[model samples]
Target chain A: MEVAHADDVELAHRIAAGDEAAAEEVVRSLGREMFGFARRMLSDSGAAEDAMQETLLAILKGASKFDGRVPLRAWGFGILRHKITDTLRKRGREAVIGDVDPERDAFNAKGAWKHMNFAPWREDEETLQVVRDCMETLPLRQREALELFAVEGKDGVEAAALLGVTPVNLRQILHRGRSAVRKCADAKLGSDED
Target chain B: MDDRIRARCDCFYQVLSDYIDGELSEEEAGLVREHLLLCPPCLVYLEQFRIVHQACGKVESDDLPADFDVVMQGVMTAWRKDRCGDPEPGS
Candidate 1:
């Protein structure tokens, strides 16, 4: 297998050799990020913990067979993504309460901006809170897209694959999510520009 | 915005993420690039998009649950038992 990171490949080998230290290293390196990702992906604390545990177990079990086509971190994320999806499935679909289509509201039927004007963002703690609140309110798919692309730092192709959407679809989701958050923040925080 | 500028901005909006992601073809990206130079509204939107992107990245991470280590230990113990028929390596 074509390993992306040499140290990761070494770690894989150590893990395959039943090195507990290597396993602990993996946990230390990836645990917080995994928990954080799960927390954001699942609203319930117990569900997030369950997903994180499942992902870590899956990683330890699969380490012997690690092919290293991607970095160890990305591999762990893929497993975590699967766990999150499974958890979401078991939870069934969340309620569609007050689901407004921002795209329709923002763009005209002909695709021109209906509201072209925007106040420059006033970056502050309040702005961050507004963005977080807006993100939480977004539809699951759009939130996941933003999480993977913006927060998790996955590229378009990788995020698209994780979300099981085409690149075009991923972009659409990201754009709409961004627009909604921007609109929300602008409304709440007003213009930094005087 | 003028009708012509609005028309161009419409095209740009559809591909905003793609443009930011560098996924657009060079020709398409160049067109958007040229449009941003003359279009204040679209330029503001682009900058705003970037700000939001940065803000998203700044969302604080919550600490792991208190029982995280215990749960992980439980998993590793179970896995060890499954692999070696014992909870501990030798026992």
Candidate 2:
């Protein structure tokens, strides 16, 4: 999935010129990544599919206006961000405004490990199941941040750009996400020790 | 540890992902580096974080479904057809 910059730029040029072949190439190249992002953002398969379609349509309509300053994938992701936001807005849904509670403050002060024991994760089926279960329990925004930055290996700034959030906010999301995942891992791995 | 230094250590860990990814400003990075040198706990935390980070990547990227490419192709075909009917404006 290492798409070279030159290739993306050339494909983007063709797409801007209304080349159907290039459009197909663009979709083929970016579809899964975009779908994965949308799925995590919405946490609903149907909504993700709809959002992906809208994003693709926006790419088709807006291709000609692209200035080519940013990487094509980055621009495409930016378009997807807007499409997802619009879809969410239309559904009358809003992102949760997380509060900083005493528990969070304590966790922050004492270090997350103080509240939980850490054990090495095994590669057994049970271990994998626990990991999956923990991942599913994360809030949508935190999960999206983890998937985009950690799983997809996108840089924080690029991920922030794609999510349409400030880098500071993105950092907060990653921090919270990793902490939650660590807590889950700790709980699951520690159970075997008892 | 001084309370002030401990607070900075917590902030450093909170932003450790950013730090590892080179997202911080030079000044911020220098501050974190200084803190890491003096703080053994935060240093251990960073090491453990890296392990989890690498492990997650290994687990998630394994075993692509055989039909992944096919599924993408199907989606691409439909997407292309949706944009195909527009006559070149000058034509």
**lDDT for every model?**
0.73, 0.63
DockQ of structure 1: 0.47
Tens digits of lDDT, candidate 1, A37-101? 77877867888777777777788878877777777877888888777777776778552322344
- Fnat for candidate 1 (0 to 1): 0.63
Which CAPRI category fits model 1?
acceptable
Candidate 2 lDDT, tens digit per residue, A136-185?
A: 56655666676777544646677786666887787777777666665676
For model 1 chain A, the run of ten residues with the poorest summed lDDT? A93-102
Error of 2 at A146 (Å): 1.5
- Which stretches in model 2 have alpha-carbon errors above 4 Å? A1-17, A35-54, A61-72, A78-103, A107-129, A151-154, B1-12, B15-48, B55-65, B83-91
- Which CAPRI quality tier does the interface of model 2 achieve? incorrect
lDDT of 2 by residue, B9-33 (tens): 5566556777766777777777777
User: How far does residue B16 in candidate 1 sit from its true spot (Å)?
Assistant: 1.7
Off by over 4 Å in 1: A1-30, A43-47, A59-79, A85-101, A105-111, A151-154, A184-194, B1-7, B24-30, B59-74, B82-86
Best by lDDT: 1
